[model samples]
Target: MKIIVVNDSVYPLTMGGSHRCVFEQCRELSALGHDVVCVTANEAAVARVQEPGGFYLSTYRRSENSLAKALGFITEPARIIGAILREKGGEPVACLSVQMFPSLLGLIWNVPKLPPFYYVYHGSYAREMWTQLWPRFKRSLKVSDLLGALYGAMMIPVERWVLGHGRFPVVVLSNYTRRQLIDDLGVKDDRIVVVPGGCDTQHFSHSAEGRARIRARFGVDDDTSMIISVRRLEERMGLDCLIEAYADLRQRSEKKVKLVIVGKGSQRDYLERFAYERGLSSNELAFAGFVPDAELPDFYSAADLFVMPSLAVEGFGLPVIEAMSCGVPVLATSGGGHSDLVAAIAPQCVVPQATARALADALVDIFSGRTKLPDRSACESYARQFSWGRYCSGNLAVIDRVLAQKSPPAQTRA
Candidate 1:
């Protein structure tokens, strides 16, 4: 099969769960004997490069001007994909659009010749923006966040039309996202396929040396329990709640515990200030900023426990799976996709709510031996099931089914 993947960004060049998903899917499709062409806006060393996984990567530079940005997003990707289609010259193909904007614009730009599109829906962008920014806008009364919320609010209708039109196939990362589409956007159940995002189980496995190195680097001793969280330092991530919860936990628990927050974002300064305000000492809370891709597994392995304190839009916490894959127990808020994975592995590990009280109580329970967390082997076993290979295979199966349904007539028309 010949597949053209259209998305705004690519992984490693630009990091995120969605970008990683796009890169992995394209790589997997190519690996499975399909000729794959990925057109994205991620600037690499070259405009067009062939990846080791047997896929072609075409990239475009991002513009500094606002109007240019919008125009480029619509035109640049379409132009690249148009060139690829012309080169193929009537080959049977399908489009795997990773984002709505690119898909919508690309379809408009090349309506006559564009192939059947399979939308890789990663959750509603408008809803995510509203969920993440509205609360901040209310609290801070910041003009930027207010405008952001409005923009996101406006996207709701646009998403509804694009997702539901023609009843196109929409691939979601979790059942949580699938429910959102049905309830919020009124997308039919059959059109949505729940393919839970995966982790690199092998790359993220337990490493004693790595564990010791990371722990020692952070000045965490063997006697002290290290609670780790790997996420973008943002308000929506609930890091503030985590800090408050850690303070509460520190007050009650007799054990020596430390919290290590990983990843960097605009919230770093705010989080640092909040940590101090919570009366947490430097020894008790350490911020490790911007961990590289190669070293992420080590950070996961260093944790005795992993926590996901997402306040909202907690769409499939990839860190939860990565931590579990490294033979570490995970506890998360009882909502979103990560909760599903955590609940399936150990029901007791899911925090009852996203509040500080709830999170703190759960931490206390685990430390005090009141709640039994899963063992290293158990976590490893459960995480192994959601490997990237399985995710890719599931995607390919969906593609096959969609293509079969769109049979000879559709192929001839294209």
Candidate 2:
């Protein structure tokens, strides 16, 4: 079936997990003999166009200037409608997969076309904004916290309107998000589908040779234990807590453990400052900011342990599964979807949220060889469960189901 997937971002842009997930799913879908056309904003369009694959691509200027950025917030639906009309040429558009911003546009435009649109709710915008705002303000703009909170408050209505009025089957990345849609948004159980983010098993597979090369490239000695965290340097990521915990672990551990932080964001400077304040140097913490996707597996395999100390609003921790695929044990916070995934794979490793002491203790346990690493075979097994092929198939099935059901409500000429 011909499918049009709508998201604000896609691959090569390297913005977030959702962007990469959508791009990978689309690539896999194209490989599975489906004609898939991806529509993204200007910022991500160039990347998708450059992707060496056979998928139809359309890019649009979603916004013009800074002023347009704020105003284009309301124009997203019209832009999507324009793109659909131009591309589909009146062919019965099968399914519309709506991400966060474009879901509203899909909801508004689908009213006339009545296509089976699936709302892929990654996480609640309100929760994400709340998690990001306070820490960012405290670290960067202390006075801006109130303004950030107000902005979040203003976004509530828009978020509520989209979730409430979309009236389409919801595709959530985790069971945790599925429950949130049901309990928080009052979405019915039958209307929700859980298809978590997937990994390219081959790309992230366990490789001893690759690990050795990556270690040598990073200047990490073979005898030294490596702890890697592949996440944005942001407040919600709990990097501050991770750094504090690592400092504590350093004081006690006999073996040398180096923390490798991958990815870059606004909070990098604050984290660097925090590390300095703790009397740690660049040697103890390596900031290999924003490693390319191709090189991610090396980083994963080079590490002895993968750490994710996210506090909350983590819809699904993609890196955790990637690390698992690389046969690296993971330790994550018992918050949001990370708790669910970690529980499923290795429950003993999930520690309390924001508890640096608990995180430090867990790290020390792994460092001291007191806690055994997860079974390599089991790790590989879990990784198989989240393969990109399975993810694409599941999503395609949902799209087919949605398309077969109904079109958008017909529009009455005014």
Best by TM-score: 1
- Predicted candidate 2 versus true structure: per-residue lDDT over 279-380, tens digit per residue: 899888888999887888888888988998988777788888999998888998886776788888788788865688999998888788887778778887
lDDT of prediction 2: 0.76
- Worst 10-residue lDDT window for candidate 2 reads 64-73
Runs of candidate 1 with Cα error greater than 4 angstroms are 43-46, 63-75, 88-92, 100-102, 105-110, 132-147, 409-414
lDDT per model, in order? 0.80, 0.76
Relative to the unseen true structure, what is the C-alpha lDDT of residue 77 in candidate 2, on a scale of 0 to 100? 45
Instruction: Return the lDDT, model 1, position 179.
Output: 84
Q: What is the lDDT of candidate 1?
A: 0.80
